[model samples]
Target chain A: MTTLSLAPNPALRSPPSALRNTLTLARRELRDAVRSRWFLLYTLAFTVLGLAVSFVSAAGTGGSGLSGFGRTTAGLVNLVLLVVPLMALSAGAASIASDRERGMLSYLFSQPMNPSELLLGKFLGLAAALLAAISLGLGSCALILAWKGLRTNPQSMFWLCGLAFMLALGMLSVGMLISTLARRASVAVGTGIFVWLMLVFVSDLALMAGAVALRLRIETLFAASLVNPLQVFKMWSLHAVDANLDVLGPAGLYAVEEYGALLHVMFAGCMVAWVVVPLLLASVVLSRRSPL
Target chain B: MNRLRLLAAVASLLACVPAQATQPDHAAPSADAPTTSTVPTTLGEIGRRVAAAEPGATLVIEPGVYHEHLRLTKPLTIRAGGKVIIDGGGSGDIVEITGPDVTFQGFTVRNTGIDLDKENAAIRVLAPRAVIKDNIVEDVLFGIDLREAPDSLISNNRIGGKALDIARRGDGLRLWRSDRTIVEDNVIHDGRDAILWYSKGVVVRRNTGLDSRYGLHLMFSDDVTITDNEFTRNSVGIYLMYSTGVEIAGNRLIQNRGPSGYGLGLKETDRFVVRGNLMVGNRSGIYIDGSPLAPDVPGEFSANTLAGNDVGITFLPSARGNLIYANNFIDNFNQIAVAGRGNLDANQFWKGDAGNFWSDYTGYDQNHDGVGDFVHESATLFEDLMDREPSLRLFLFSPAQQAVEFVGRAVPAVRPEPKFTDEVPLMRPVPVAALPASSSSTRMPLAAGGAILVLFGSGLLRLVRDPAGGPGGAL
Candidate 1:
């Protein structure tokens, strides 16, 4: 009690300390990311193939079918769906789980660096690699979409890439969550991939089945559509392309026209929920758990 | 009055001259005609004459296998006899229309080889108001490629291609950016798709699309009405993408046989009215994707009976504000898949609105009220995690999910009560096709607004940044 001073700690007020710590963590992550052979290989292979396909198609190698914005969209979608997800997931899944599996995380935690530093470092490392791979594909698409007196739809382009990035972040965070819970590196990776697929394909199928079984009408379909990230992604993508054209078929068209104003907000709201709820739960789960 | 009647008769008779002379299938050519006459006997001679025709003349080809490229440049009508063949000699694009008002009909164009560099169409019409009808275009990459030109009619054609072995080939009739085109009464098969487009004002009717990627694909199109067609044995029968004002009615979507099959898939489309269509024997009857695109349009699903499908209807996002009314969902793998946001309630039809008829409706309508006593609100903890991990759907029937659904439904406090009805849902499917082509007359104002948006988005960004930076202002 006597030793405990009635004064504030200097460390709490020192801005340089936090900044220095952040920079140090970032630098360390950069070093680790640069050293990762697997990420490098994956990014390089994806970028090369992506650029080649874009160039060949743009050069009119496969007729006018694969020319112009169609080629660009295909290339971008392929990259986002296949390449970006892989890079982000693999990097994140192995970061903590591998450390724990090798009994290295305990040693690192024992050091002066705090949990914030370690987590931030790992995230930054994975994010850097992900950004690099995504940037390569994005640059290629940009080059193709840009021409003399011809421009791609800015809304479609931005939303496509933005949603992909958001999806990547969500995947990476999920992988990290799996890493925190798993006892082995391989187990975490498998779990992460399985989770990814379920999110990508299965959840929507199940919700659809539920809707059918219950005889849920359009509002229910709309409500249940939010549970699937793919639907959310599609909604955002369609909205970005043309708010007017997002509604298809008898039900969708009617929903948009009749309840024209609310559809956009509803779509946007679903997308935000998809991003936020998962993140918040993951954060809580991670915060409540032990590092090792 | 007698003089006027005589003049009218003369004008009518002059019109009949072209029709009678062009009917080579029924009428034989005159024996006095020369082989190399300006009214060309072979397609090669017709090609030459068409290229050198006056503004208002006609270049007619007689029945024969003319192995040449018929390229037209003037405002002329190139008519071919029923047995007339424009063989490509293993080259590409037998007939090329590059002029306005060019009409080629009653021909048997064949054997256009595959080229990776150039998409070889049997007849590639690049002119406005071009008509390619009643033609047998075979073994070509694209049968009739109408690009950018508007007001073309491609009807009564038998178009097909040999298996290209999945090297990304074949589109039977592709109209891109060509407005007010009518594609009707065609038998198209063994192609990527029967009809594919990115244009407006297309009326596709009475066609048979078989063994194709998509039977009818309307992408970025508007004011399209697809009626009285048959889509069979295709991967996806009908696929609409980023389109609006599409009315699909009186069509039979038959067995779309595929490895991973789907009858119809509507992706990023809006203002579509699908009614009185028969969807039968497929993996999925209709899949409406709510993925994001620019200029977003909401979806409306109604009045189409989905029967004899592996899966009845699957809504990816259950929470999306889609209206599903008056649909008869009968005997399938499952009824509806509401996988997204929002709520679900048992639809009450007699309250002036009708919900989809699921074959699996179990709740009793007590007191003969016709409305089910129980309201089905889709709330499961697995769905909550589905937002985080979508793969959960595969394991949706797992013990964990069952437990969660049971416990979650029991605990009303935690369960999400998704409301499935609008107080004023549509009484019936909107008659979009019947809604006169008012979009065109009203489109000028919209186009003006669009031009303004583009000018502001594209032009103003530079003007405000000129003083700040040079080319970097684009960022």
Candidate 2:
């Protein structure tokens, strides 16, 4: 972990531009993600889950009589809710924190690039990897379904994949924020997992309990739920498949009635904001703390 | 006033017109070059022919468009020779059959008046034993309004209502006190409802209706048999209100998602058998509101496949005395829900070791028997809360719902009691008669699928076993 071996010697090489440095850093991060075992495992598991969903939906109407529109996608969405954010958080929190722990950030910063570039490059690369994994997993499942001559709607799958990727990006941004704040890799990883658990399970339960106990207004509960991006993902992803969100009850009905056809655009915009805002805050923190 | 001056100028303009231009087309012999009295071209000419005919005579109408309203007072068989059209000039009832035993067949009757107060219809039958068949009644208000026409038949008629607001449009087929009638093979759409008010012994079969209000709405109609009908995209499929001895069988009710989106709404209905129907994609497959209202009579529901509905059976809290067996409740979000907070224990979930097959049934069949080993009880605390506050359904398939379910599982004290217990739930779906094939789905193109397969297949191999070893030491 010596900084001398990676010293920025002016006699050896000229400095590249900021864009080039960022791209180089991005490519490195992408390669790292590609090589990771957990990434591959997640993709494989997603494929298996996709196959199960298709099989369950297509099992059919002879005597089983489970006919009409398939609702097995709900299971897929549930699993996505449980896992996609965790995947993004772990991968993201490890990126910068691990570099800091290995004494690589100091050496890397000694080069021509700035801290903001490094963070942006890492975020972009991780987001790209996440998107690719989501696309391949969902696309392979759809492709398998099409080849099997099953009930495959590519349009619906497209929206779902987009939703999952968008959700992952938001989680990744939050992970970047955690990584920027925490000094140790273990602390960052632990914080990321804790955030995931709180977001995925406990907070929602507490909110529900609090709402019931306090007899909170539906509008209050609805407004409060939107703070959890997972809730937004659920609202919109379920809505993508079934526009009539009767299963979702009143809140879903309100969303449909309030937003109508533009609800998808609203969801996409909200997700984009979720990604951009946290990443900006992380960049500010990183640049201030590690003055290049 | 300026209006009075304009009226005087219009009157002066009318006075300047030639006297010949004011003559009528129905005037005696000036209609055409060869004016044969037998070949009646106008509705007025036909009315003359009908008036001169005997009490029970057959009038074969020539193929042409008659732009006038006509009424038949005596018993007559009016059949079209080829393609007879009776256009009402968009002002009044096209045809009125007041004669007993009159049969109107093989005509395209259209363009009836749009006056709601007059109840303008294409064919308004007021006599008994009339047979109206093989007709195309369109561009009209009320399609075939039958009043006191007993022992009559309306068959093979394609009827469509006027293009107006939904509330402004009239019924496609309205029968009032018309007993012992048969409505068969009619395809109706874009109307308010096909209602049978106080009509008894009416058999409506093989009719296909869509984009309407009610497929077949009945009020106080008894001994009605509605079978082999397909009603899709309607407000309510078949609503039997305050009726007895009705049989709704072999019908397909699909996608009825309007405000009152029930495939069947039985409000205080008694002695009904709902059998062999396919109820799909409805908000609530069957809304039972105080049904089986008779003290001793129970509603018989059997062998129906209720699939993909939001709630298979939504019962008002007071609904009970229903014998539900041999049905398939599949993939509905909430299979059976009570509208308010009440258990469904009063209704019979099984009868003598025979019960419906539920897709959400967690019980398994041991020893390969047809019946499940454990009793299938369906009442999660979430479902109970949903019944109490329907808005709670918003949490379905969300973490909040799963969190509640987890808590309910960990601590049984907070878990509400089960709604219904199936003592011997069926292991398999009952073999109800097959319905029409599901509507087609647009599949992903082969090229797209191939592209994905090729990209992912090779990309994974190269990426997983990267030749550059240990590149991500920091990660």
Models, CA RMSD each: 23.3, 11.4
Deviating ranges (above 4 Å) for candidate 2: A1-23, A52-69, A106-117, A140-152, A214-227, B1-70, B79-93, B109-118, B162-165, B437-475
What is candidate 1's TM-score against the reference?
0.45
TM-score per model for chain B alone? 0.67, 0.84
For model 1, state the Cα shift of residue A120 in Å: 70
CAPRI-style grade of the A/B interface in model 1 = incorrect
Per-residue lDDT of B1-475 in model 1, one digit per residue for the tens?
A: 5553453333223221211221232112112211121112355666666657788687677777777777776777667755788778766667777779877778888877676346667888777998888889888777787776799888899999767864456577778778998888999998876554567888899898988877877767888999988888786788776677888887877667442245676666666667767676665677656522332443455666665564555445522434556665554434454434433333222234455544444455555544445543333455554432322333332333445566677888867544243333222222222211222232233233334333433342233234433222222
TM-score for candidate 2: 0.84
Q: Write candidate 1's Cα lDDT for A232-283 as tens digits.
A: 5555554455343212222243344345577667766765665455445545
- Backbone clashes, each candidate: 91, 2
DockQ score of each predicted structure, in the order shown: 0.02, 0.24
Off by over 4 Å in 1: A1-292, B1-43, B49-55, B58-60, B194-197, B257-260, B291-298, B339-351, B365-475
Q: Give the range where candidate 2 chain B is weakest over 10 consecutive residues by summed lDDT.
A: B29-38
For each candidate, report what fraction of the true interface contacts it reproduces: 0.00, 0.30
Best by DockQ: 2
Which 10 consecutive residues of model 1 chain B have the lowest summed lDDT? B29-38
